[model samples]
Target: MDTITLWELVALAGAATLVGFSKTAVSGANTVSLAIFAAVLPARESTGILLPLLIVGDMFAVRAYRRHADWATLVRLFPAVAAGVVAGTVFMLWADDAAVRTSIGVILLVMASITVWRRRTAGQQAREQKGQGEEEGRGEPAGEGRQRARLKAGSYGVLGGFTTMVANAGGPVMSMYLLSAGFRKLGFLGTSAWFFLIVNVAKVPFSVGLGLIDRHSLLLDAGLALCVVPGAFLGRAVVDRINQRLFERLVIAATVVGGLQLLLR
Candidate 1:
């Protein structure tokens, strides 16, 4: 195939920056990169092109917040995520592009809805718990904490697996989950860094199996990866300044809009 057009190459570089920024600042905006890839390349090949870029983004993410991850969270979520990945891979084998896109869109919508509803509920519960003269600063009871953890692991794991395999859209899935899990700034970044690092790397073999990554894709990835460094630097500067609550809300809203776009297109 001929090299990508000049406009397309510029678009790819822009999208790569967005991918890096999403990894650090706002997770859902990686959809911008996904859309760029789909616009320039065949849908399946888009996955290949996006995968290595994501891995590069993940490295930057891990380096920025390497010390804050909670190992327990990663361990708790991996098995379920693995199952979801297998299911997603199988789904990809049978599902057409439209079918896959629609499915991913639907899944994202549901995940966004759930994230919003749970956040509202948690906020209300936090208010109630604060007013009830029970726990002063602590938000919820022990049971509620366990319940939330389980729900986060299960829901986010499955959704992350499905979206990542289908469209590399798992970033928002885990972002919502980690936000709900109430990890503070560095912890959230670190945990997410480790999580996606392991998961994305694991996906390499499966991506190859699906013909989503190959020699040509690697060449493209090498060029695109160079752009992630500056993006990562810019994202790191902004990450702490971001209002975590507002960012999560925006992510949910953006994810919903992206889902609608996928469905309509």
Candidate 2:
């Protein structure tokens, strides 16, 4: 902690504040925080320092949106996420910093592209349906819907687990999943709040096994975690004012930026 320069400390505090804000208002914006921390600290150690701050943010998010969680969806995702987390831990032990960063960056970009394409396709379909005055066939067949939902939950849950375990970069991926699932503001926040709170907490023992959390890291976190409180409050204050469309756009934009940052950094 003492080795960190003043500017670095300020940057971390700012990023920590964004952590709080991201939890409550914009879910994906903390990719910026992730990038900033990785730049200021050792990439591997950055994940450790950031984890506690995220858990703190998660606590607040859960408290605010606990009732809105989609427990069924969470149930479907947990097993896959657990598998992914284990795979991610193994990968972390095997891969170096560059490999981890580059791989995660590529994954983020690909996920973002897929999400954009899905949104466009869905929009076009909606337009065509409206133009044709065909509302009866708007929803997919029940079987098809179930199949698609399973596919999405499995794919996204695993990826969310892998990326978050490796670099704490799961927010964008999960945002894509939730957005594609057609979650609204409160529901989105609520489900994600519980999803991450549980996933991150479950990751604690593995993180410790990896030596990612320790006394020094905890001390550093204690210094920085307080900033997250104000940011959370600020997010809650303005979140209701943000409309659905704007919220989606913000999430997508942040995801793109986060992917780009990782790829280029």
Candidate 3:
């Protein structure tokens, strides 16, 4: 921990705060924190250090929105996500830092594009529904909707698992999934909080085995965790004030920028 400069500590503290804020309010905004950690520490070690802080933030989010979770969605996603995590673990055994960064960056950009496209489609569907006087399923068949939902869950689950495993970059992918699923603010926050908590905890053994989380990382995490509390409170305070459309836009914008930074850096 003493190896880092004072400026680096300040950046990490700010990043930790953003982690808490993202967990509760912004959702995908922690990609900024990822970039900061990676910049400040070894890329691989940064992921380990960030994980505990993320869990701390996740606890705050879960407490705030536990009742709003969608268990059915989680059930559908877990298998695919697990498969992806296994794949990521295997990849990490051989991949270097640059490879991980570039791959995650590409994935993020692709997911961001898909999210924008989906938002446009959703807007179109809403307009069509309005034109049809809000009759449910007037424009789309229930079966088709179900099929699309299943596909979304499967694809995003895999991507989210893989990204999170490799780089702690799954939040953006999951954010896109929840937004496309038509989750309102509370449901999105609750489901995301729970999903990450379970998944991050699951990764602990793997991280330990991989030597990513060690005594040094834990010491660093303890310091960073302090910054998360105020950030969590700030997130809780501001989440409701931001409207849905604005929230989605801000998340997407931050995701795009994070991806680009990872790629370019």
Clashing pairs for predicted structure model 3, backbone only: none
lDDT of 1 by residue, 47-109 (tens): 777999999889988987788788888998998899889988998788776776677567667
* Ranked by lDDT, top first: 3, 2, 1
Off by over 4 Å in 3: 111-115, 118-122, 125-141, 145-148, 243-261
Supply the global lDDT for candidate 3: 0.80
TM-score of 2: 0.83
Residue range 1-265, candidate 2, lDDT tens digits: 6689999999999999999998998775677788778767777778878999999999999999898887887898998899889989998887777776676566556655765675676565445434442322122223447777888889989988998998888887787677566555566788899999999999888888888899999998998899999999998898878674665666567656765776688
Score each candidate by Cα lDDT.
0.76, 0.79, 0.80
Q: Which candidate is the best by TM-score?
A: 3
The predicted structure with the larger TM-score, 1 or 2, is 2
* Candidate numbers sorted by TM-score from highest down: 3, 2, 1
**In model 2, which regions exceed 4 Å deviation?**
107-143, 243-265
